[model samples]
Target: MNFKKCLRCGCFFASEDSVCPSCQTKDEIDKNSIRNYLANNDTPQNAESLAFQSGVSIKNINRFMETKEFSPLKNSFK
Candidate 1:
């Protein structure tokens, strides 16, 4: 099996995924928080604002955008 370093935690993981399981879980939580925030509020927000409100890093938010994990706020990022 090929072992690779996790992108988020920098820990070695024996898998093809960039982020480890732990980071993946955290990422899900962050994404959920951002989704909830968007669902509750009517105004559009940029990545920086979402990161600040959701306590997730700006980089992660950008990654989410690239992956299209959250479609509702896809165009909200500037």
Candidate 2:
């Protein structure tokens, strides 16, 4: 199996996903939080604002926005 570095924790692992298993769970939680925040409030101007309001880190927000699942959100940010 091929080993890849975990984007969130910098650990090496064998997986197709960007982050390790543990971080994947956190990513999901962050994603849901972002969705809920968007549902309740207007879209923020950028990742920093969204991160601040959603309680997620700007790094994760930026990473998520680049994914196909969050591609639609890309338009909402700068």
Candidate 3:
């Protein structure tokens, strides 16, 4: 397996995924949090607002928005 730098923790690991194994769990949890927030509330204007209201960091919000599952959400933002 090719080594890649973990996007969340900056650690080098052998994986095709963006984050390391440990961080993958955290990513799942954060994604759940975001989904819960969006399910109950109106979509925020942008990542910053979503991050603030969802208690997730803007960095993570931005990162999540890059994925195919969340890419449409990025288009919703200004």
74: Cα error in model 1, Å: 4.6
lDDT per residue as tens, model 1, 1-78: 999898788899898887898998988888888778877976356878888877789888777776746654667556
> What CA RMSD would you report for each candidate?
2.0, 1.0, 0.8
What lDDT tens digits, residue by residue, belong to model 3 across residues 2-78? Answer: 99999999999998999999999999999999999999999999888999988888898889989988888988888
Q: Give model 3's TM-score versus the native structure.
A: 0.95
Provide the lDDT at 38 for model 3.
94
Ranking by lDDT: 3, 2, 1
State which candidate, 1 or 2, has the greater lDDT: 2
TM-score of each prediction: 0.78, 0.92, 0.95
Superior by TM-score: candidate 1 or candidate 3: 3
Better of 1 and 3 by lDDT: 3
Clashing pairs in 1: none
- Candidate 2 stretches greater than 4 Å from native: none
Q: How close is candidate 2 to the true structure, as a TM-score?
A: 0.92
